[model samples]
Target: MTLWRLEWLRLVRTRRLVAILGAYLFFGLTGPLTARYLDRILGGIGTEGVRVQLPAPTPADGIAQFTGNASQIGLLVVVLVAASALAFDARREMAVFLRTRVRGAAAVILPAYLVSAAAAVSALTLGTLAAWYETAVLLGGLPVARLLVGLACGALFLAFAVAVTALAAAITRGVAATAGAALAALLALAVADGLTGVPWLPTRLAGAMETLVRGEPATGLPAGAALTAALTAGALAAAVAVSDRREL
Candidate 1:
């Protein structure tokens, strides 16, 4: 309880979250606005009499654009934040007091992963909500049930990112190494899923998110959800194990 509380308190007390949320919020607004006004935006900058004809933007188009930005750019932010989850540590002598006082290394890792996942999920949820509302006002509202499914797709990927980054942290030191490893692992998952056509990978969930947003059936949803749940638990266990083996 104390660890969870500490992790949550640290997350809320920092300025990093404000910046991350603001960045995602900007994307949520701009993605739809860009899709909605692409013609005008291009026409305004068109060379004299050079016409740029564009297709009529659909709900799917706007949602696709938003998800594209969130999955790639938004994903980067999640990795960076999650990578920093374990940036603090005391020197060997200085670490003794707190290190020995806790239940185990898992106590440190679980709270960090859980708290970071919560924060990332919340940011994505709010950002998606903003994008949804703006799409309705500026474009057209996606059907509510489908919209929720699409949102879950992105949130699920974020949870995986958080878990993967926590695992990276447990095994590595420093922000760059943790983030780099985490990104590498996620990319590997994507590539493997593509080659193997596995339905249970977190990358599948992310891909399914895009599919769902576009009014298509996410046939892989069930398997992806099951795998995500399993992988999250497994990744947390791995993190705890690695952290335990480390010299505090």
Candidate 2:
């Protein structure tokens, strides 16, 4: 069987595909609902002597909530699922089997990495479409062109995330360790971007949806998106090189 087909079969058989899609779908459906009802929801809490005033819910707020959920828990799920696929060689028997059949590390690893990335991007796109529909119903219609651009930016960031998982898997000995290392690296990048407020940081793509929804000029997004794509390619290359040298 082709490696690509094998990866897809593995993802489905293991149910990671379902988990990733389900998590994003849950957030997509709830994000708009939460944004629309947030004021009433807060009022029900009944904090004594605390008056909380919130702006009326907007389409931007709905999309923001969706991206916010995606950037947090959704991102982690993607990383874990990607790590599981990339780290399949963690078992000695599996490693030997793959090493013997594949021409090189790239042959063994690229399909798994690309399949994981494709699954993640597809899930995110599905969730984004769900959020867009609910936002149009609950709030108002958003700019389709801007939202599409933002979605592209978000997809690039997710692809980069999977690449990071691939690199971590190449270096780490187990699935958990690979996931942890990739998450740690991502967290550090997020913190750095938060502190520096750099326009070119790939982390900026995480907020692309909210920003574009608010009608912000996507002037900075191109830089961030380019950097994200570059980083993803570099990470994939590094993963292949590192895996090539490692002892099976």
Candidate 3:
């Protein structure tokens, strides 16, 4: 069987695929519901004397809720899943077996990275559609063009994230360390993006959905998206190089 098939089978046997999809889908289905009923939900909380009021939910609010949740905890699930798949050295025997059979580092690594990336994007797409449908039903209709654009931007970020996880897996000793390192790297990037206010930072893609829904001009998104693609390619190559040098 091909390495791609093996990587897919690894995800399936480990149930990481289900975890990834289920977490995103949960956020997608619930985010709109939460937005639509937030006022009512909050009405019962806190105290009997206090009250809170919120504006009527909009399509942007629904999508924002979904993206916000999906980008945080949902992204965590993707990172953990990808790191688990790419940290082949966690299983020393299997790593040795695969490395000996493969022609090169790329042959051993590319399939796993691509498979993880494909799975991550698929889960994100599923969640995006779920959010769109629920928001349309409960809040309001959204423009398909804008949603598609946002989804494309989001997918590019997911690719970059998986690439980062791949490189982390090459450097770390085990799945847990790989996940922690990748998450730290991602968090650092997010913090840097927020502090610098750089229009071209890839972390801006995290808000692309909300921005598109809010009718904001996406002039900076193309640059961020392009940089994300370039970084993804660079990270993947770096992962292969790092893995090539490591002892199996």
TM-score of each: 0.89, 0.97, 0.98
* 60-147: candidate 3 lDDT, tens digit per residue: 9999999999889988999999988889889989899888998778997788888889988999999999999999999999988999
lDDT of 2 by residue, 150-194 (tens): 889889999999999999999998999999999999999999988
Q: In candidate 2, which residue pairs get closer than 3 Å at backbone N, Cα or C atoms, i.e. clash? A: none
Q: Which candidate has the highest lDDT of all? A: 2
Residues 1-248, model 1: lDDT tens digits: 47688777767687667756876787788888899999999999989989999999987777777777877788888888777765434235534654787878776777777778877888888878878888888888687887787678778778878888878887777788888999999989878988998666788766554577677867778778878878888887898787777775
Q: Rate the local accuracy (lDDT) of all candidates.
A: 0.77, 0.92, 0.90
- Model 3 has a clash total of 0
Best TM-score among the predictions, by candidate number: 3
Better of 1 and 3 by lDDT: 3
After best superposition, candidate 1 residue 180: deviation in angstroms?
Answer: 1.1
Q: Cα deviation in Å at residue 43, candidate 2?
A: 1.2
Worst 10 residues of 2 by lDDT: 44-53
Better of 2 and 3 by lDDT: 2
Instruction: Please identify model 3 stretches exceeding 4 Å from their true place.
Output: none
lDDT of 2 at 83: 90
TM-score of 3: 0.98
Candidate 3 residue 155 Cα shift, in angstroms, is 0.5
